[model samples]
Target: MDKHLTPGHVICLINPVTVNLSHNILVINCGSSSLKFAVIDPESTQVLIQGIAERLNSPDALLKVQPLGSQAIPYINHAKAMAAILASLGDIPIAGIGHRVVHGGEFFSASVLLNEDAVAKIDACRALAPLHNPAHVTGIRAAMENFPELPHVAVFDTAFHQTMPPHAYFYALPYDLYKTHQVRRYGFHGTSHRFVAEQAATLLDKPFTELQIITAHLGNGCSACAIKNGQSMDTTMGLTPLEGLAMGTRSGDVDPNLIQFLVEQTGRDIRQVTDLLNRDSGLLGLSGLSNDMRTLLEAADNGHSRAELAIDVFCYRLAKGILGLAAALDRIDALIFTGGIGENSAPIRARTLAHLKVLKPTLDHDLNSAHGRHTAGRITTTDSALTALVVPTNEELVIARETQRLLQP
Candidate 1:
């Protein structure tokens, strides 16, 4: 394998003489109510096109497609959406399809080509991820129905974090409960965190086995992870995504009794409480306005008391989580920021790193404002011990690479 010359950008220059697989691959990532799809070239590790079908099984469903070298096209429902996506492929002959399946449930350790047995194994773990797995199965089944001849593979989100040691993943609960129900911390954002950490390693001109870093994915669902020697030592999210940092609407960490308290006081059912925690909380709950951080920040700047408090709390929790993650890494080399809030919100980023002044994370005030996709540069000052980078996370590329690896014998 010939490595590309660019730093942090290496492409395996397969000579075709040693390869037995096809060049083109399609990656499918299905979420709770959405399906995200991509067509990629495994040789160059480039995504040619991408699309998403959102609000599936609902009336307000819509599909959006950004065709290869073209603008985005929006559609309605999964069936129509898939057809549009297929149409967007044009003459790009797809060799194989790889899917992103959440919660592999200790069954899948790496990307596996999908077969009847593998599909059944994925189906069996539905209870572990009621919101995600069903939609994933549905989307994969749709792909199977549409492209029966192509080889299909399943790449898991939880698979990357499987390297997490027992201490980091295990909960302080009964052994029987964990064994019987598979109740333990299965960190989400594994794909993104793993992808960026690898990117960090590449940028640092270091191998994964020699790097120690912290990756913060601060999108709607946020989490901090400590990666030591390319393995997840600890992550903010535990048991479920709801257990992490304050998100768009999901209340991050809450009192265990709060659920019971709300249920009894409001005379609501379990599902109602679940909706509140997952949809009506977080910045939305605190500000009582919007879940969006940008709008919250704007309002906060205008002297909106609740919005200010929400912003403060969000940054504080994020910093606190990073401190804990740093402790896990023992020594920090790079601190990566990705996702929506992490990449764009300079104020939020500043607030987060300001608390880490002792860690000597100096912001290149100018550079922080211009951060964007795939651009990883130093945001820290000259005197800082640790490096702060806005390394954009590319989970799709990670999935595509894993797909390529699985296809090769």
Candidate 2:
């Protein structure tokens, strides 16, 4: 225990059920329409309870708890969802609360204890991440109101990539726009990227500080990170999450002039056009069917031409991003794939890796297809110069650990 801990902070040491306070940390990840919550024991890295509140603020709001069950609860807003989550936990002791905030801007480079000042800073960054930070603020306020006594910590998605050099994070836009408005690449999924990179080090039995790795988080939201010597040297998602590889609905890396061209052609307002790119483009727009990769894959297999095109574009764009990020590294050590499409889709993996012949990566078909349920290990041949792996990311665990560290006695 640290000497900084006072008697007021000793309540965290107590168990919710009067059994033994097992040091359970409650991790919350609030999205625009849903909230994912988990109670994890950091000591053993075990998840005691995990669930999601979906369709929040809508009539179809639902709460699903793993290992328990689910119910259609009327969660009018994130506050109600947080209340329901607390009620579902019964008496499980929560040593602390960890909130996943998507963008911390350039102000925060690491996780910090949540205080009024911290909340204010996060609120100030709301404009930088209009789609995410506002929802995060809502969740934070609710959690702070509900668990006023417990220590609350905020773990940012953009924190890890703060190590990127100016040349890497800066755009070609006017220097004044960057200096005045803080317009630059602030990568998302830092927790996921960092978690898998460290896990890669353990799996390969190499010093993390001596490796150059590229991590691709492929899901509804995708980004590729270039990490050198255990620090983020560069990443794909820039300023916002919409600048990386084409996501489920996001049009990644579009030309700046496209906005003006669309505005002129469609006569839609800027916000509407932005919404179209962020919510109705990518796989959904290209396939004219769904934003889900599974659905696209199925359609492609059934000879759906548009679906096939969507998948091809996704893979090609992802490969390009990976190869481009590789330039930030002196040598390629491993190319790690995580997230939904990365961990589960063998065909997607094979398609993406096919374009990376320059790295000499050889994927074992059996190993790539056999790994199930977010298992972490190599999916490439042992002799391959650049190893490929499918390491499932646990951002919640990272949040929990950060919270516990901040609250340690």
Candidate 3:
């Protein structure tokens, strides 16, 4: 790492070992049974190539690539999948690699160059993120093995939120639980929030470090963040992704006693009840329809009572949550929306802003409608009190930029 580096003036240096030649970053995001990756040009933030290796170690394991198509790779594990990914790269040059690790816990506060000690620290944080951290470690090791010479960086989803104040992150639970077991509100979707916040700052023509913004990343998995002066002051999601907004299948913000209550009344075990909330609840549970927001919106328009109620609850809760996050900041410079639902769903945006009557956020209906898929910009009226936008987030691009920044010499 270089001792003298300036913001927005990062110079990608040549390494003696790998001789860094290009400015492209290979961004890898690993799930429990899938690896979604992209080759991004950090300078332009363009996705040069994108693909995924799915159902790893299963009989139906398959590898899919854009502009290349799909094919089955039998009994494909993470290492084999990584090898196939590297093999398919052909002549596209890569300067560095960026990996998305879901939970860094209290270990990493920012993106770090992957090494033995870094890997060990990441693994240690797995006690809190049992399901995600292990798979990330597997993918990191696999990528390191495949691209041994290239520098690899771990861009944590939790790293950006490590700046959160203890009062905001701590729950009302026992103090000993936080000290000993490391239990607290470690928010997710931080990468998306940070990306959109920076974009908001750019669009607002203000320094990110001086801007107070609220970002909502509402996809299948949803989370809201209150960013003050480029730092995560407070966020909705806590401990796990399941604690935030009501997601596609997650019943967010449920009663703490509901789990045991369901166990006693329904005769299901604690695990079963918990799974119900995590998997079977949310929009699907509320409407008894598909988890797809589009489907619910269409059904609601068709006079489906349950679907209408589901959409109502989703928008109400979302609006309420957004307004609630404002308490963390003195005044919000911008309330930006990103992710699938946040970016594309015009109705959701309108409905959400409608509930924010106190903020007097006037929406440009035409502008909101104009911001469909592949389009993003401000959607608030010029005279509106708040500047609300529909900024489409690119987590891979953010990871690539972070990789480039960390690779500076």
Which structure among the candidates has the greatest lDDT?
A: 2
Give the residue spans of candidate 3 off by over 4 A: 1-21, 372-376
Query: If both were scored by TM-score, which would come out higher, candidate 1 or candidate 2?
Result: 2
- Model 2, 322-370: lDDT tens digits are 9999889998888999987888889999999898888888888888887
**Per-residue error (Å), model 3, residue 121:** 1.9
Candidate 1 off by > 4 Å: 1-22, 57-61, 67-80, 372-376
Candidate 1 local lDDT, 1-409, one digit each (tens): 1111111322333344544335678888776666677676766666555666676667666655553232333435555556667876776677888898887888887788899899988988898888888878887888887889988888887887788888888989899978999898888888989988988898778898889999999987899899999898889987778997988899998888998999999999988999999999989999999998999999999999999988888998898889887777768988999887887788998899888867877677787777733345567765778788888777767777777787787
Model 3 steric clash total: 0
**Model 3 C-alpha lDDT per residue in residues 94-141, reported as the tens digit of each score:** 999999999998988999999999999999988777779999999999
User: Relative to the unseen true structure, what is the C-alpha lDDT of residue 275 in candidate 3, on a scale of 0 to 100?
Assistant: 86
Alpha-carbon runs more than 4 Å astray in model 2? 1-21, 372-376
Provide the TM-score for each candidate, comma-separated.
0.88, 0.92, 0.93
- Quality of model 2 by C-alpha lDDT: 0.87
What local lDDT does model 2 show for residue 37? 84
Candidate 3, residue 168: the lDDT equals: 93
Better of 2 and 3 by lDDT: 2
User: Which pairs of residues collide in model 1?
Assistant: none
- Candidate 2 C-alpha error for residue 108, in Å: 0.5
